[model samples]
Target: MQSTDVTQRFLFDNADARGQLVSLELAYREVLAKHDYPEPIRALLGEMLAASVLLSTAIKFDGLLILQARSSGPLSTLMVECSSDQELRGIARYADDITGDDLTDLMPDGVLAITIDPDDGQRYQGIVPLEGGTLAGALEGYFANSEQLPTQFRLVADGRVARGFMLQSLPPDRQTDPEQRAATWEHLSILANTLSAEELISLDNQTVLRRLYHEEDIRLFDSGPVIFKCSCSAERSGNAIVSLGREDALALLDERGGEVAVDCQFCNASYRFDRDALEELFEAAEERARGLH
Candidate 1:
């Protein structure tokens, strides 16, 4: 059976290339369930989710990777996040009358920002102009500008499932000849371009490889699970409230009838804080500050 909610890595044993395949079902549905997004928005968000997982696994890091896009078109914002552990959550904001099907139509003049925040090191971010009218195109531009690696991506989402295929040329350590390296990358990219959206979303990883690279030496890796998990909690909500200062926090509580409601946009999880909770939250924050001093 075709695997769902899983990501797998594959490598070309005979070429200086590697790739990743991601198929998401449950995680995609979970993210869509949080809000009543339009069909186009749903499809775009789904693609972003799949792309995030593909890029996350492609890199070596012990932190979070965020793909955020902003524009002046109907689709104002698109954000997808994936952690090193494969946990995923995403959300999109669009005008109610949104009817665009492609990135250019939906997010004209948009810019995509890719951020990698390592657990023990400095965070890094790269901004790429949203070119080629698709998420995959924008990402290819990012790799070309930042890593200077030849990369290509095929992404598809029908609101039911989201699937992605990424192929990148690794450093030419084994193949020192520049001409051969270019030829190899071109051959692999051409074959990968033949892959259809239907096949990518429907076939298993092994089948995908066999169908795409039947003439090449391919090395397939084990698959890993991808899940929808929002990193929101009462503690985090309380911290946000405390960050607003005790006076404003209490004022907002009063304005909202003695309670402040904090809602997580990703998961639709709500956290409510009353007078007692707010008072105690600030008191504890104050105590921590004093201790630090």
Candidate 2:
């Protein structure tokens, strides 16, 4: 049976390569239900969500992996983040008349940014031009130009379900033959290229691997669950209000009829602050600042 909202890692025993397969069902639906997105934007958002999960698995950091597409076109920005624990959240900002299925049409002259923020270390970010017509192609270009690794990605999403498969070549081991390693990577990539969108979305991990690399020695690992989790909270919202300064917060509250409402873009959760709550928050912030001084 197929598992929904899970990511599976696999390795080739005979080649210096690794891959990740991801399928998102409930989590995808949860994100879409938060807002009404056009078909093109929804599909692009779904692909980015799936890509974030797949890319996160390859990183050894203990924080978050964020994928962002920014452009001046109809689709202004699409952001997706995946935590180390496999939690995911995403949002898309686009114009109302976003039409066309091509990435270039939606995000013309855009840039793709991949950021890795570790829990306790320096952050790293890479930017690549969105030259290709597809998100997968842009990602492949990122790897080629920045990481210099031979990578391939197959992403498919139909709003209800999002699926992704990633194949990357590992650096040749000291003991491995360089020519043979190259040959193995080339062969595996050729087979992976034959995968279709229908098979990736409908088939299980094991079945998909078998269909693609039935002749190769592949080791599939246990699957990990991916959940739709928002890292927003009342405390965080309060802190944001505090950053606005006490006077501005109070003025905004007064202008809004004594309540300031903040809505999270990722989950659409609303946090409202009235006079009393704002006063308490500002007082606490002042006390903390005093203590620091």
Candidate 3:
């Protein structure tokens, strides 16, 4: 079992299907260390993080891919974001008594939203009901309903390691025979279903693929590293405070004993601003406003 974090992309030479395998060890540990999340929430967040990376690899965007789940049960919200550069961050909000193991038990009447935010273009979001027993099932349902494609996902996380595997059918243009395509997809999906949770979290990408598809000719591409990185900063946090208007910012500053602090939910990093810093930030914001006018 390698300790490095990586995502590998591969294709079946004999079928019109492509896949991605992601293993997260250090990144998983870093994310878990940021907060004292309960066992179930930690596992859920790990799955969401791995799923975000796996889904992001399928797109050609230059920004972020976010996986968000909101519900009316004990687990209120779970959010994970993975950038095109493979940087990832995630957080979850839940009640103190949340002890459910199944997705429905934790997030009853939940909705899963997948958002693609490109750096240069309009953002796209797809929403679907979280209907499956597990996170992987909900994601597969999303692909079937929204993308009109057959997709399969297997995700496992035990607080120490998080791993995910995704297999998606290619577009119709890629295959001439529809029956053959369907057969190939079913065959590969059945083989993938045989993967155990322990193997997914413990084995390397090459060994996993070989064990799953030993009879097939698969083309494995270069692997990319996945890192745990929070995009929050003092400047961004200050801008957020500036959005609250001058009077409100000043009131917060005064309430906090001359310093306002903003804590990032993902990484728990604190950004503080004193009265002088707030004044300077507001002055610069006003200057930008005047320039716009």
Candidate 4:
């Protein structure tokens, strides 16, 4: 059996290609436990969570990778974030009594946005129309249009387990031959296309790769854990309260029976602040401001 809640990277020694496999068990259950989402919402959120981790490993960033889907249909919003360290969290908002299974039926005019937020640099976002009726298909369009890379994604979820596989063509610095590159890419994609959702979700990483690329030279690396960890903290929440400014914050606190409450939508974690706590937060903020001057 495959290791639960981990991502493993692989490379093709014979071709300029690379891939990663992600399996989410405990982490996915943790996210689902936070919200009572509909069946479709749960499944889509699982896929998004798997996708975020897979994308995070492919990118060379030391921050967060966020995948968000928004629409006006039954499934209104879905968001998943994965950090460089493989911490994951996700949430979904949808209408009740949702019966639709296809993306077009659930999110008719939806848009998928992939945002890269680096720890010490500017942020970048790419938006793509939700096409091909599946998250995998829409992401393929995102790569085809925005990144111009030959990439393939296999994402599957059954509300209990979420798993994803990604195959991408590396830059042609070593291959340098267009025809050979195309041939190698086509070969890998053809083999990957033969992979069934059931097989990908059920098989172990070594078994899956052996079944698909038994004849190819591939290297599998050590796996890293993927966990469900909310980035929200009392300090961040305190900063948000301070962002409201002193007078308004105090007035809001007074209206809320001398205490203010904050609930994180992602993890359902609650943070509360009384008048004294609020005063201290603002004082610290002011002191920091004065020090900066």
lDDT of 1 by residue, 27-102 (tens): 9999999999988889899999999998898778999999999998999999999999999999998887887778
The candidate scoring highest on lDDT is 4
lDDT of 2 by residue, 1-293 (tens): 64589999999887789999999999999999988998888888999999999889877789999999999999999999999998999999988777767788988899999999999999999999988688899999999888888999999999899999999998876318878888888889899999999999998899999999999888999999999998999999999999999889899998999899999988989999999999999889889989998
Report the CA-based lDDT of candidate 3 relative to the real structure. Answer: 0.91
Which has the higher lDDT value, candidate number 1 or candidate number 2? 1
Error of model 4, residue 99, in angstroms: 3.4
Per-candidate TM vs. native? 0.97, 0.96, 0.95, 0.97
lDDT of 1 at 107: 95
Stretches of candidate 3 off by over 4 Å are 1-3
All candidates' lDDT scores? 0.92, 0.91, 0.91, 0.93
Tell me the lDDT of model 2 at 192. Answer: 93
Residue runs of model 4 more than 4 Å from their true location after superposition: 1-3
Q: After superposition, how far is residue 291 of candidate 2 from its true place, in Å?
A: 3.6
**Residue 127 displacement in candidate 4 (angstroms):** 0.4
